[model samples]
Target: MPQPYQTQAATGGGKDQEPTIIIGIDFGTNNHCSDKEKVPSAIYYNEKGEVSWGYSVPEKASPLKFEWFKLCLLDEGDIPQNLRNAAQVEAAQKSLRESNKRVVDVISDYLRELWKHTTRNIRRAIGGQLVDLSRFKVIATIPAIWPAYAQIRMLEAIEKAGILEPRIAGETILEFLSEPEAAALATINDMHTYSPTNMEAGDHFVVCDAGGGTVDVITYTVTKTDPIRVKESVKGEGKLCGATFLDEVFQTTLRRKLDKISPDAWQILEENGALSRIIHNDWENGIKPQFRNTDQHWLLQMPTSGLNRKRTHDQFRFSDIKFDAKDVQNIFKPTVAEIETLVTDQAKTTKEKYKKEPKFLVLVGGFGRQPFLYTRLDDQLNRKKDQTEKTEVLQGSGAEPWTAVCRGAVIRGLELSEDTIESTSRKPNTVVSTHHESITHGFKNDFVKPFKTMKTEFIYSTVTTPPERCDETVKRLCKVRWSSVPDFNSLPTWINPIGKVVRRINYDVKMKSNGVTLDFEVMYKNRVMASKKIGIDYTCCGSAVNQFHDSDEDSGDD
Candidate 1:
């Protein structure tokens, strides 16, 4: 028998070292997964302070249970207006306050559990000897529409969860790819059924990742097909119209109907877990995915104690509530409409840029697997009576819909590690550097001249044509600062004409872009003094800084 959870290699080094193993983690709002299997994103804490997470969580709602906590990571202003008043969000927030935990802390705890299970599964598949001896590389997926600050918080949570412990900095042990990009990679690489075998180099396709909490859309134009290379045709767009919101709407509808029939019964159901069972077990697992505009009626059984009591309403004759096809359609209308709008907008943008519709619209994610959603989009895109050109809609194959993002992340990690050539390789979207500058500052002894710290600021504008000079449209992105300079005292000093000792230092400010992120570095004589990465927010032009220093100064000039 093989030993379980035993340490093998101290460090992965040398030519004979084991190959790096790629692990992809899709940290979703409703569920989290590493491979084909997924666990609920819910977490529960007992009175003794012990915690349970994922699949171990109870099916019914509990006061100690925390669900939809992922959305709490967004600032108040960033949350969708409709979701602001959602009961699930309120419950999660209450749980956080009761537990005295921050959103990042909760997420970190949950990720720790996910990592343990993922590694255990890997060990079981490949055996302990190979697993312990090999190095691990993680590729995590994030929402495309998340702001820079949110992404930073996610990274902090991932770091706190100890997922990056095996590898040192600058070794590419961990990387984050946008959800839609990952979905596209999985769909194109693994789904031979929908993969465009005849797709030409200039052909374009759109990927719509409709998950449990967010729906993200992006268009990619193929540059090569032999080894599969593509680039973003337009910036991606996303919204909070996911499957959970549909559940929220359904629950709201049920409550309204119940209140009208019997307020006392509604209260009793809420006090118990009957309402939760109906929503989670009956509607979510059964009705939502199967409803496809068919004329079918669903009779949901209600608790006999309160609902069976005699009432004036004729529909209350039986201890059940009836939901017709129209009722289900109403529950799905608002959320599905939002998703349709997002996909349509992406299609329009792709057409504007490429002068033709995308050849295919590939759908991937847990929500994307819904037959109703696929049928709706198929009819709208391909069967429209007013349009002469139609775009084909394809569901991702070769991997479970919910696992596509994680699988694609693993595929990307493998590609990056194997591709050795400088050119003719699949790479991330090109990020062009727009600005560069060099600044020299002199500090006199009279003005605190130790040169212990230095600061740099990055500013950006979203306007198509930015003003030549800094204006109201320009916003500060982030600030990068470095302290405890090792060579500060070695700098040559001279006496100024005013008889004050002066020290001057010159450094270059360089900006580098990686995917949707921008990195700024202050370099002194080929040595990195300070560096910071800022994620680009495609949704709006707002001030979001990932500052490296605590102090806030207007300028770096002295």
Candidate 2:
């Protein structure tokens, strides 16, 4: 049973009120660091079948530790689904389904371990016995652009992991939020520390959350600062362009070099996991954050244990290989371009729709602090420095960039607990800081027309595959951006928009296996913003049509 905490608000005798701990699990694709607010997302399964998480899990414990498991849900078709490789992934996929392993099942296993271990460190965080689960509030940040079902699946996974009981009727102990949105809340509240210029009400800015797996951008104009709140100024944009893609480019370049040295060496390197170890180690330590030099080339050392015992750089043993400036540039060029495109797209849309440009572009997430990345984006997006043109790109100082999402999540959970306390029968006179009431919420900007409209129910196309049950139907929601005013008389079952379609969030429950899946496409002028699989009886929380709220739909960008 989920019961509100009886804190100082309930009984104001003790100096220390048992804190409502907000534990944010950053379930990253490459790393899972929650015990200390950040850790390698790697999980290892031992021979006895017990699981060990965080990078500290012994290397010898498992020959193949699961990394990039989060990437399995991407289904973008650009990246390979089988991160562990084709053969191993194939067998595991079969075993996974047969064993009833959903994606969240693997995620839950890691989080369950994290939850059990967090108790040891909870005293240092907020100081309270960690016996009861209800004493704490847990929040897991999801990528802003993930499908609605993915969010639901994450909650389901959390409940299954024994962190919280699955809530069917009311508000559960856990809640879902966009990673970028969480970062924005963190940034806006902490503007005094990060922003160059203090932002005022009605001042607009963009939040660019660049992480290992995705880059999510959403523009907002400050609506109020009496406990900060804002309105969505533009449709948020999320791209697959992230830090891991740069690692992929580096991997490709490394493989190309390795193949030239000796194909056998590359094969042996793969078999022994030497190449991967070298690639990630070199990238993370040697090149990634510190690769700021554009003029000079650096050298990358090869693993001494691999089959190609002989180093290729100078035909000497145990020597370093040349990774020239060109090689580094080649590895970064494509990813950098993708990032520029996303930022520029947001900027262009901001200018086009709002008539006034944004004042700041706040970058947060693991990759947000990359100097090279910051330099390029600042050079491109920050076109002005003087008061007239003040838009500049900013990142968190110190560890703020990497930990903003989780920190913001913590702030959110704390606030929720405070609200719960205030609502109690016996409320203590506890004064909270003005910043404590930072509540950020908004309805999705629904698309509507000004002219006369005809209303009709749209039935989706039927499926041809075998039905799992007699009355099974999947609802697919599509986010669309329209290029021009669409003809309501002849609406296309699928959306065909003319403008920038930010993202089309498709649910992972494969439409191929099911016989009857209803595809619900949500359109904004020229873009398909979101799509998802839903049961036949699923209801929508927001609508695309409204007479009273239609005026607010036009973004107040300036």
| Best model number under TM-score | 1
- Residue-by-residue lDDT tens digits, candidate 2, 126-234: 4544333224546566765454345545665677778775533223345555566667766776773455247777677888878776677878777665555666666
What are the per-residue Cα lDDT tens digits for candidate 1 across 1-558? 001122224355664354556676778877666456556788887889678998788767666788889889877666667677777778888888876889998898888888887788878887876776576756677765555556667877988998877543224356666677677776776543354575667777788888777787888777776666677676677777788888877888888778777767776776655677788677977898788889998987776445445534453333678889999999888888888888887888877877887888888887887878888787766665766667888874334432333332232221111111110011211222321222222222212255445554445433334445555544444545567354546666667677877565656655553433446566677787666643222232234322223343422233
Model 1, position 298, has a per-residue lDDT of: 91
Q: Which ten residues in a row have the lowest lDDT in candidate 1?
A: 417-426
RMSD of each: 8.9, 16.0
TM-score of each: 0.70, 0.60
The TM-score of predicted model 1 comes to 0.70
- How much is the lDDT of residue 238 in candidate 2? 63
Off by over 4 Å in 1: 1-20, 34-38, 46-48, 55-65, 77-100, 124-126, 167-172, 191-196, 252-281, 299-322, 383-386, 397-452, 459-506, 509-556
Clashes of each: 0, 35
